[model samples]
Target chain A: MTPASSMNAALERQPPRLMLADPILTMTGIEKSFGDVRALRGVDVTVYPGEVLGIVGESGSGKSTLLRMMNLEDMPDRGEYHLALPGQEDLNLFTLDRFSRRMLRARHIGIVYQNPHLGLRMNNTSSGNVAERLLMAGERSFAVLRARAKESLDASEFPISRMDARPSELSGGMQQRVQLAKAIALEPALLLLDEPTTGLDVSVQALVLDTLKRLQRERRITMVIVSHDLGVIRTMADRVMVMRNGDVVEQGLADQIFQDPQHEYTQQLVHAKL
Target chain B: MKLDQLTKPWEAFSYGFLDQSAKREMRRRILKAIAIPGYQVPYASREVPIARGWGTGGLQVTLTLLKPSSVVKVIDQGADDSVNASSIRKFLRRVSSARETLDTMEADVIQSRHRIPEEKLREDQILVLQVPNPEPLRPVQPDMSEARIMHGDADYGQLWLTLYEQLVRSGRIMQGSSYPSMVNGRHVMTPSPIPRWDVPKMHMAANLTILSAGREKRIHAVPPYTRVEPLVFDDVPYRIEDHADKTCYRSGVTGFFMNELPQDDGSSSFEVSDSQYGVKHIRRQEGEPVTLGETYYREGRLER
Candidate 1:
């Protein structure tokens, strides 16, 4: 075997660390472009198990693109993407075929879109929308479907009575809760949230954020969140990555990043937020 | 390059409005559904000109099986002449040029929404029942993936408990339509929105029944002679709607499903819910020779 591969093989044989030895996700030198426009360039991010990693950037800063790549909805032009699933070795995501990638996304990764319409089926009941994901994962019994959906919705602090209401009938905050319920129904190992509280009112945003924080704590799953709002990142994320013009400028612990920003752009963002 | 090679001969539309590939896919799924009786088989339900939830499932099945010589019957709540039924019938005719019949006995394929025919369906006939919600366990198990596992394990304890609770509270099985029934002692299927009376017709029946839900993207089947037993305690015998004794005021047909028409007075008059059967009765009374097929219910009671 080659030197690097032999080292990797040796690393695989070693017993996994009991805690924080390996990250759940590792993306190295990820490069992506849309025609002539470069969306992401040499981006690298690693998130430990159960850690909430936040990506904060202005619009068109490649935050959404990188988030989508984690779920394999968007492919990087070049990168080494490795995801270590629970009870499994780190999988080289891009090397695996398309079907395997989809199965992985369906079973291991849960994504909450910025727009609830993109994630929630508007015509189906809120519970039904959550049930759709469970059904896709091969659930068929109505009894278990209802019970599990009720539990997830209850976890999000959504009213039990409104579980039967369609997403169109719900308030914006309630719809986001429904989307969260849908994503987490599979009990995915990785949760991705994109601007989950962007469009809601201040009070509603708090309610949604609180519910989300509770669920994350209760589930204890790895999370990667993308947002333009630094306050959201500070509230929920353990680590924050600041990006600009399709490149990450700085990344550190959430507190460290806020207290002492090194990059000029990050410093400007911090000052503006304060 | 010849003209024939450049383009095919002019035609109004494909045989079933659905292209050949779509029809082929439907045929494959239908065969699989029939083989695994009462098993909900998934399919890529294609978009039709009609809306998604409006009998599109039954329409797709009918279109797949339809031929120029096949006689088609479409019914909405037992009425062949209702706007929805006739409109579907017209659409089928426009696409496939199949013969349209109001008589259930003469139809090779019958697509129905929410009800089954009063006249007994024959062995050769195929019943395509439109299902709004195919998952019978939806009320009990809202998560479909878990529901599927329950089906695989044949775990229906919760469903039975639900019935028991209903019986304890209401003193009767209060489920009005889409009564859940066990097919072939295996899967419990929602027999579309068919009334309780029409459900027993599926048990040890001579016709093949296909239940499809377009929006839900599922198709399940019950073949001839398959056992379809409704969920019930052995002590409390299964009961249908209490319309066995009511007579149709218009057709003078007694001992069949009836639609109660309320009058300006405090009372209500009843008419046969099966519109075509009533029409046939009216015509036969006027000296038109029409043979009414044998029915599942004889003299207000279902005959085994």
Candidate 2:
């Protein structure tokens, strides 16, 4: 059976009512508009827990917009969005107010922007930036904050000795790692990544990609990564969604999308990458 | 308009020149600052009659702690009667009805700019130091938010590098005042532009030191019994000013810090920087009934 068929068969095996149950996120008819332009047009996405879902598209394709929506940084003009947290009922993210959304973002969502400068505070020490997230999570103990900061840095392979140095003093790859450390410090259930290694050197990108893949596997984190780079998706994501002009053109298992493309836009993407 | 609704009561001015709410906020921040020994606590620094940069931070702390029974001493560069010091002292007294004293030993709370008193402060005393720049990392990292993060991380690599460069460029470290010193083995604080000699006095001292920068909007504390070590390389030891042996010309006091009066002939006359200390010494010489407290330094050497 084809990978797409297999995915459908797996879904069919589960109870019909429980199909959307315990997913990391569920979005239906998500529509966003900027001025007269449609940023996202009727986008629907469902992410399973512990799965890495890659959304691939060029600029203005609404990939970043979709990721931002997941992060709760931006609200769609119209849509139903539900975030299923572990040991809790599905959170109606769209219905919550701003402060509640902020609390949810701090507690359960971690977003890594394309630009390190946008994602991380350049002057804060690596560990400090991480501790900030912990502070937002209502951690008051300095000793505990320091310990957790150090632990997360160590886990991300960030040099413990350099924890005190600001982001401006670090290399680009190291800065990204610091951002990762900060994002993961609170142990968020959902990780939203926006072109995480877009500006790094090829070798550095490889290393960062490897670290990210390893981290996702080890932590069993549910991730929605948006990138224009096909290689990034092929390496890190288990499933792939192709977007063009604010709409998903096609989506399937990573291997299926690479080996056999059902849609013309996806075929062009695969062809362009090769 | 009803008189009772118009105002609570016809008062000359608020106590301590700050309303109750302002004092309460300051007290809350002060407690947090003391709890996290060297950490810079951000507070809603209220506006007073004084300008933002001129000892407003120290004034706020003093006002928050002031009572009718409190004895306050205000000093500028060790002189108790300088324009800045006397003005602050007058303001403190006028607003709070607190007694003002020139003698360091008699004062319950001492508000100072750029210098610690020559005399050792008792445990009951609280030293409010007016800081122009509170960030020790400003020279290395210019951004305040970034500097704060650096403080959180305990990442001070660039600070050491700057010192190393200073030693290489000039045979000695060129840092003059506001010597960067580590507090409680965790935070590096700018000890309020006080000379190197005064910096050491904060190290495991009996009195609580509150360094507040009104312009920068940050307050940090060096609590009693906390370690405050001036940053230095292993090979190059931290040195106090060479004025150790320079005697005060007017009072004949040889061990204390001195202010130089430049003469036309290129020779500079040195006077005791702590004006009150010198006054006490001169009074005692004239056979007046005056008692001097134990000083931090004795005979040009800092006593441990």
Candidate 3:
């Protein structure tokens, strides 16, 4: 059988359904340090499938570091990263070899960094950027990759006809959407977004967020977004994790974290936003 | 004091003063290489105060390409710790202070001579070859201008004819050392000074093959999946040489072209008698080991 046909069959066999029976990602007693400075200290969090978990914190509060740890891009000095795979329960991402973890990230996990310009190659066309992950996953045929890339762009509300245009020609929001298209093209089980809408204007941010919400619903993708914007967290997050000095001060449903914040730090954050 | 004699030490120290400028130039060349993806560029190469056949080219490339996270490997012949290999390794350690490895499988950047490692290389890994001469046409025509003009017009007829003539004379092409092949069917490139035994292994190889001539100041690449054909004649056929057996005493690896070692007793003990015993013995003493096993023999002839 052809490779494309086999990939299609595999996609069909595992339909886009949320599996919430077990926690998709679990971080236990996580701690990180750079030289003498401690970034994260004794932090624990759990992420379930098909849920948008927002991690809100101030600058230098270790939100980005935590996200990096989750993606296995940076290993914590002391932590356990137990990630759930299909038919497997809580595999430690940190313990795996670099190649194996790379394979897992390539096939099952996708990350969108904060800088849209950095996320996608500026020299490559939009379609090229979108199709990169698919190509890396052993999809060699240009026709099939282009088709899937086009479909993803259209789904993400991007201008599909302009797929040949480079990222430098596109606006910040459009670049973010192109990155989203790239991440979603692989049909990743987990999506880790780090301030994906920070550079875009409000209108563009709303459009991008709406696209993400629609994608999460259709693909049943689990999302963990790290951002400082409380408004964004309120709009998309099912649960909120409020961090302070590398500690999760409050974590519960978004409403509870916003309306009935128990910790002083969370209260101060809400007051500052107000 | 005689002016020339007095100025000699200053001339020697001038290389140290010129190092920063040379590195900047190399960085620009490397950036151009990355920007164009597979294109090679000429850079101002310095005599690294090491042996010519050593990894001066690889060292220069690594110095230009290194980041804090890079893990480097250096191999000579094939094993990691031959005398020349250790010499380059020590130089890099002293110069770049970068991490070094003997394991081919783990290196992010590898500097190799004579043989590509038996292990598969990852896409992220970069392989740099030390090249004596970058031009494939230098052997046929001694003049640089004529060779350059021939390369410009993609004229490889002379090379093909030479191979055909060798085949007619010997029933097989018997040339070795710095074998010539076409890169992407566009540029005729020498696969450095590796033995002819390792020539066929570079065909459509997985890693990006970068060749640098430190003395010549030229760089080139054979991109992944690009055709690398050794010029051959149809009647006699292009045949590759291999050891009768794959055995390396030091590395204990199989399926590798090996160097044969002489026993300490000096009794002419046969380590599987085959063609080119002297060359193999010299290579073995130089720390290249034969791959363990019986030599792969076909009808009484051992294919190199």
Candidate 4:
């Protein structure tokens, strides 16, 4: 093997650093309502760095809303969202203004939508889309943005040659890679994904999941992924939060959540997936 | 003319000329521009209470598109403090009480003429260029109908020929301001009055570039990463304008194109002038006594 390839192989084999000292994201008594439609009701969840936390729930269970609330995309009507920094207390994300929240999202948080199209700016090229969050964070130089974009695209296993190609020209899997490239580019502290592989084919799904796992490992990023697929959740999540009708029905280690689900909803979900 | 008869009718008719209907129509056009990305739409143009050649399009657009929180910056020729620049800046302050900025980096909405700012614009920032005309084919084909047809068919043969002729005459592309371009490689558009130096800056620019011609009643867009090529032949390629003497009196900015103001004595020697028509007098009065505090404060702030 070439020297570079051997080094890369060795790096991949090395165990990632365990930096799970404190919670990066903490949601307490989070309540959200859309004009009589209670999307979330007193949902409490915490996420730690170097950890993958899966949120599993059936349709209309408010799992998606819970994830959105964590990212500050959807503000809970009543709750304390304390986003933990390295040496700082959990910040109350809900109290901050819209602009500040958006800035925080751009700087510290990255979100991947269930539909990759929704996550990506379809009109821009792959590199442009990847560079967008960084641009929004006030990284203005074209050269710096381009270089970072190329690096991120390569890290995500996206074709660097197709960096100039727009989302419309790419396949679904390729577009998803662009979305992944965008999310991972910022090296965000918290990565919130809403059913990232819902619409993808099984073969494509496996590839995307593998890439995501590898990225999470490399970056030591804290993740909150909402998915109904128990198998995917088991594969990717270190811990699991099972929600039903906006409330977290159960929370435990991934192995425990699957092997011995305490909640009836979690059990039914597992059975249904099986 | 009897005073009683004139006074009685004047009161009723005086308020009638203050028709906000035209402003409403411009607002509708601005909305349509947002809804239909990259589609140039025409509206009933109004002569904004500002100068004709001076940022009237940008002023009208700003007036129509302003939200309460919008931070605005107006640059004429490229610098922020030119005479025409201050006039529009003052007008926006009077009309909307929107926050005004001199820093190109800080502005949420920049209304510019002749140049894009040297600073790179952010995605949230929207650039409104004051356009003399929106049709890129205007120089090549004067007929509006023919221009539209050419744009509809993507026939840019005449545009290519014009560049080819420039090459034959000057050995390089001579076209400067109002550089012709293809928006999204679909619709022919203009980059307004910015120099050829700033023309290449528009290619795949991060910010949304919007052009408005208040007199022409048209609005067009160049979405981010859109191909914005200046017409050039292979043998004689497109060249950016060079500024050997790059200097900004106030900002200490160098290597940017500066306007030359002819002295009143009719001397051939040209003094550095701001991009806008009127602000040279202020700069002259301020003189080389660089008030370091003012410069520092202005630099600290962002332009809108």
Each model's TM-score? 0.59, 0.56, 0.51, 0.54
Model 2 ranges with Cα > 4 A deviation: A1-21, A87-90, A94-103, A121-174, A201-203, B1-73, B86-101, B104-304
lDDT of 3 by residue, B135-241 (tens): 77886778987887667656665565445334434546677767777666676777887776666656766667777878778777766656777665333345555
- What is the lDDT for B71 in model 2? 99
Candidate 4 residue lDDT tens string, A183-246: 8888888888889888889999999999999988878888889898888899899888777777
- Local accuracy by lDDT, each model: 0.85, 0.84, 0.71, 0.71
Candidate 1 per-residue C-alpha lDDT over B154-231 given as tens digits, one digit per residue, 9 for 90 to 100: 667556655544554466778888888999999999999898988998999999999999999999999998999997
Better of 1 and 3 by lDDT: 1
DockQ of every candidate structure: 0.02, 0.03, 0.01, 0.01
Q: Give lDDT tens digits, candidate 2, residues B1-304.
A: 8879987877666778888888888888888888888889988888888998899999999998999999999999888888888999999999889999999999999999999999999999999999998888988789887887778767675666555445434658789999888888898989999988898999999999998888778899988989999887555788988778888888898978999899999999899999999999999999999999999999878899
The DockQ score of candidate 1 comes to: 0.02
> What is the CA-based DockQ of model 4?
0.01
Per-residue CA lDDT of model 1 for A2-83, tens digit only, reads: 1112211111111123224576788877789999988887787777788898899999999999999998988999988888
Candidate closest to the true structure, highest lDDT? 1
Best by TM-score: 1
TM-score for candidate 2, residues paired by index: 0.56
Q: Tell me the tens digit of each residue's lDDT in model 3 across A119-211.
A: 787766787777667766756444576688899889889987788787899898999888888888888888999999997899999999999
- Candidate 2 colliding pairs: A123-B146, A164-B155, B178-B193
Q: Write the per-residue lDDT of candidate 2 for residues A24-66, one digit (tens) a residue.
A: 6788778999999998888878788788889998899999888
